[model samples]
Target: MNRKAFTLIELIFVILLIGVLSAVAVPKFIGMRDNAKITSELSTAASVQTALEACHGEWVINDAPFVCGNGIRSDSADFNATTGYPVTLGSGDDTPLDKILKNGATVHWKKSGENYYGPASDPQNGTSRCIEGKPCIGKCWRYDSAEGTLKLQTSGC
Candidate 1:
């Protein structure tokens, strides 16, 4: 007639403790995940910037060739003459920025009155600016061809 089962009160207490712990930990874990994403995006942006500079240097060394690899010398049909960068993310065969930032993150472009975004089935054009230095998530990596600048937004992330 000996029973080794735990009491109902003990089981309830254990369940309550688990619930409390989970409630405290879930949000922290989510925040951590978001922070990680932001950090990764920043790193990608830095790498792309470095690559862009290198490409520009090469372009300079070659006496500013009109066409090299996927880069155009002047403001060609697809690239910008001022910065020698692509006008849009995927407009040309394979832009220098594209080769550097391939598959890293979606690249958004900003032109005079036209805008183009990538990785979206129906990318909106000229609707909004992507590199406004705002804190955002999922929309990481913005390339301003006009100024030849690449930025990573992570405030909302």
Candidate 2:
């Protein structure tokens, strides 16, 4: 005969156990935030396809002759003496695909026309050829810089 409160069936069983634990933790936190954004867009398309096959195998070990666009090895890095890759899948900064996968091609990408890609709703008619992927729930990771590809489209999530 001395208790003072909480007995409306223990406040409706603690508000029905906090609405059943927020309805089972909000769809498992929105399915773990869409599986951590498709595992960070599949680890940024496998580190920009291993830095576009190590800058096209260092432009076929530099014997591919002349103009690596910026890099030979000391890492100014931009490749493409006619298909060593990265004349533009744009990683920004100075472009030409971030001069060797800098920032791992920055996930959920963007930049549309000049051809830095991923997550562009539409603006890409400038053409560098091979920009088809449009779907990581935000899409755009299919960059084929002269056959040094990087794919992770995931069909619109």
Candidate 3:
């Protein structure tokens, strides 16, 4: 008689194969996700860098300080007279990044798409290391205004 259903051995073999495939694929999937996150983080960093350079360019061209913002609106912000970068004050505040980024349209630097972006956990030291034990304000993509750096962290999982 033609078998209408999978035998016990066939079912077990299929289950094992699926299990093995998943075991291999799960780690790869996780790695891909981490890579994507790293890429996205780099992209965001580049955007902020471009914005900062534009501000600096304006300053260089004008030979004077420009108004990044009035600091009244979330979209508006303050910039440093010497650096021409946004006035972050290095207090773990997202205002500078947000304002420099024109933080309208859900560009909340504090939290961006399952990832948090803001100042380093330790501003005093100004040397933020998120994966080395301490996380930036509880697991975040740290933006160091002083050093003008964005720390990207990926997982081994």
Number of the top candidate by lDDT? 2
Question: Tens-digit lDDT track for model 3 on 1-157?
Answer: 7778888999999999999999999998766654554445456667766765665566666754345432322123444455455545222333434455555233434634222365323334222333453333234455444444556443310
Cα lDDT of model 1 by residue, 57-111, tens digit: 6555655445433433343555565556555444333332443455533454333
- Over the stretch 1-157, how does candidate 2's per-residue lDDT look in tens digits? 7997778888999999999999999999876654565555566567767766766776667763443323433233444467766655444643435445555333445544434455422233212222344223344555656566765554432
TM-score per prediction, in order, is 0.52, 0.37, 0.50
Question: Which ten-residue region of model 3 has the weakest summed lDDT?
Answer: 69-78
Residue 56 displacement in candidate 2 (angstroms): 3.4
True-structure lDDT of candidate 1: 0.50
Report every candidate's CA lDDT: 0.50, 0.53, 0.49
Which portions of model 1 miss their true places by more than 4 Å?
A: 1-3, 60-69, 73-108, 113-134, 137-147, 151-157
Order of candidates by TM-score, top first? Answer: 1, 3, 2
Which residue pairs collide, candidate 1?
Answer: 66-73, 135-155, 135-156
Question: What's the residue-level lDDT of 8 in candidate 3?
Answer: 96
